[model samples]
Target: MSASTAVEKVNLREALLTRRRARTPAERESAAEAIALHAAALPALARATRVAAYLSLPSEPGTGPLLAWLAGRDVPVLVPVGRADRSMDWVEHTAGAVESGPLGVPEPSGRPLGPGALATCGIALVPALAVDHAGNRLGRGAGYYDRALADFPGVVCALVHDDELLPHVPHEPHDRPVDLVLTPAGVFRPSRDRDV
Candidate 1:
């Protein structure tokens, strides 16, 4: 990435984070519920054989509701455990069996299924600060998800607030674009003909 692009990304990330932090707890909860409803009804999700998802941070769109919904449907959910090399190991999501991992995100207490575990998943629900109509997602700049999903063949989806669905965001070649963006309002396909 160019120096100018890097600087722009830094500024944009901070602005988005500020907006997210300004939201009320109730607003966040309501959005989460709406997002869950929309995600649960996704056609791709209904056909998924396995799913990869993240445990959202307090500032990000909460995944707890959707996670619960998936569990209720008997969907096997794989959550990420960040590794030292910035890649992620997938583990089965087990409620109440989580502890903070290397990245300070909640991780499943079970043994990791390894990074290649994502190969078995049909879809991945990821956290994003903002995403453009083209599916370019703006994350926390850690490059964790970007690296993890670099070679993933499944449909990659990003979860964000309704307003975070933007017209554009700074991105680089290493920044993996999502196939779908799920916000509180609805789901958007960045590419109409994108193969699920």
Candidate 2:
């Protein structure tokens, strides 16, 4: 990473940590609003026939409004269910029909989807603790998303607060970068090249 990028990363990391420490219920609510507004700006999301999204946890970005909006649009939404080894399994969800899974993340009450089923999705909305300009994503330090997202063949975006958009994030060659970063402010292209 460039020196400037490294510095930015440090600053962003600090900002996120500070915010996380001081986060209030009202702040989370505000962040949720921002996420909805920014997600609405993505035309691909509306046009997508199938989408993958995560169930929100405390301190993570919220998906309630986004999921509700997508349901209103009659979009097929999928949420991740944790597996035995900390990997993810996707399941379809309909409005007012979600259930709590092992990790307390909301999931579809219907049958769970296998890994092969996720390959056909047109969009994947990932959850993240932080993301960088290069598309590098820092999740909750788990490899679930990194592994599950490998087969996704469409637009992959990470939902995060504006403060979570870091200038750089630690990554390995095996890590996957999201195509876009969706925040309340707007949708940002993490990298010009989509291949990353």
Candidate 3:
């Protein structure tokens, strides 16, 4: 990225993180429920027996209710295990499987299914600070999700706050665009001129 774009991304990340930190506990919980409700209604989730998703950090949209809802429906979910190299490993989500892991990210303790297993997922629910109308995602400055999903074919959705769905975000060639963005309001498909 050029110097101007790099500076813009840093400032945007800071602003978004600050907004996340300011959310009250009750507001966070309510938002999580709303997000899960909207996401669960998707035909993709309804048709899938398995999905790839993440257990959220406290500062982001709480995914606990969604995970539990998936489990209840007998839809097994695979969560990302942060690796030393910043690549992701997949772990099957079982009851009470998540624990605090590297970089304070919530992780599953089940047997790893490895990165290649992502191809089997009907849809992927990823985490992001913000996403643009053009489908550019602003992750937490780590390329783990982008690298892990380099060639994934299924629909990829980033869970973000309603206000986090911005008009634009600085992106590079290495960035992997998402097919959809889920927020407390509903599911939104970024308006890309061409299909990803």
Candidate 4:
């Protein structure tokens, strides 16, 4: 990443996070419901034998409803646990115990299935600050998801607000673009399909 591009990503992330924090609780709740509906109906998600997902922070679009919907169908869901080395581990979402990870992100308290466990899942629903029509996603700058999805073969999707689906987002060559984007409005493929 160029120095300018790195700065741009930082600024974009701050602005997006601020906007998210400004949302009313009711607005967030409604958006979450809509996003759940949009995502749960995806053919790829419907066919997944296993899923890799995240537990959204309060300010981000809620994934609780969608996770619940998946659980209802008996889909085995794995949520990420961030490690000190900035890598991620997958743990089954048992909906039992919960604890914060190294990054302060909520993680399933179950035994980790290791990073390679992600390969077993058919699709991954990842978090993003914003994404472009080309599928370039602006994450929170931790490089956790970027590294995790770098060589991932399955479908990788991002969940963002309707407005966060931008016409473009500054991206680096190493940035892993998403194959699909899920928003409150609907689920969308990038302007062009990206090879998995």
Candidate 5:
């Protein structure tokens, strides 16, 4: 990536993180509820027999509600456990199957299902700092999701706050794009020529 693009990503992540950290507990709870409701209504999520999702950090939009909602419906959920190679491994997110993962991120506490497990998921709820109008997603800079999703053909959704769904965000060629952006307000389906 160009130096300017890298710089832009770093600056954007910092700005977004600041905004997330400033949210009050009540706002977080409300956003979490909205996200869960709206996301659950998504056609992809609604139809998927199994979906891949991650636990949200305190600052990000919560995924616990969505996970529970999915599990309650008998829809299996796969949660990521970061790997040493910057790849992601999946595990069934059953009750009590979460523990403090790398960098304190909550992850599935079971044996990994390996990177190939993502293929079984029809949709994925990925965390993002922001998503651009063109469907480009700005992640937390480790490139873990990008690498893990390189060959994934499922519906990719990024869970972000309403304001974070911007018209533009700097991106590199290696960055993976999301097919949908699920915020509290609604879902943004970017124009992409793909059969999801």
Candidate 6:
């Protein structure tokens, strides 16, 4: 990472942390709506056969509507189940098949599916606190998604509200860049200028 990029990321991280602490319930609700609108507009979502999406936590990007749409279309939907090392495994889930897990996140009640299961998915909707124009994602500082997405060779998209798509995010070498950014406005192909 360049020195300027590093400084920019630090500022973004601080801003995001402050924003998360200050967000009201209404703001969160609006953010969820934004996510839904953007996700619904993405044509790649309709073409995906298998999709790996995150199970939303209270403050995270909401996936309920998107998951429901995918299930209605008979597309295979999977949610991540966090492992011991902050890595994750995808598991199939449907409208009535999810149950609250130990961590309070919704997960599939059936057997855990493997990472290889995402091999056929044309798109994967990843959750992020913030993302940059270059696609560097700022998660909650846990490297789970970063590690989990390491092998996904297909389109990896980050879901965030328009405001969350900030100018920069605190990123390290291990952090992965998303191929696309899905915001309430539309889908964007992040600039490749910052590629490592």
What's the TM-score of every candidate structure?
Answer: 0.97, 0.85, 0.95, 0.97, 0.97, 0.83
At residue 137, candidate 1 shows an lDDT of: 91
Stretches of candidate 3 exceeding 4 Å from the true structure:
193-196
lDDT of each: 0.91, 0.78, 0.90, 0.91, 0.89, 0.76
Clashes of each: 0, 1, 0, 0, 0, 0
Question: Model 2: per-residue lDDT, tens digit, 16-132?
Answer: 767776888788878887888778778778778888887677677788888888888888888777888887777787766777877676667778778666777788898887988
What would the per-residue lDDT of candidate 3 be over residues 1-196, giving only the tens digit for each residue? 7889889889999999999999999999999999999988888778887899998988999888898899889888999998999999898888676789968888999899888989889889999999999899999888999999899988888999999999999989999999988899998888875342
- Please report how far candidate 3 places residue 109 from its true position, in Å: 0.9
Error of 5 at 15 (Å): 0.6
Query: How would the candidate models be sorted by lDDT, starting from the highest?
Result: 4, 1, 3, 5, 2, 6
- lDDT per residue, candidate 6, 65-142, as tens digits? 778777778988887787776667777876777778766777777787776776767788888888898888887666
Task: Write candidate 5's Cα lDDT for 96-124 as tens digits.
Answer: 76789868999878878988999999998
Clashes of 6: 0
* Model 1 per-residue lDDT tens digits across residues 125-146: 9999899988899998999899
Indicate whether candidate 4 or candidate 5 has the larger lDDT. Answer: 4
Candidate 1, pairs of clashing residues: none
Which residue pairs in candidate 3 collide?
none
Question: Model 3 reaches what TM-score against the true structure?
Answer: 0.95
Clashes of 3: 0
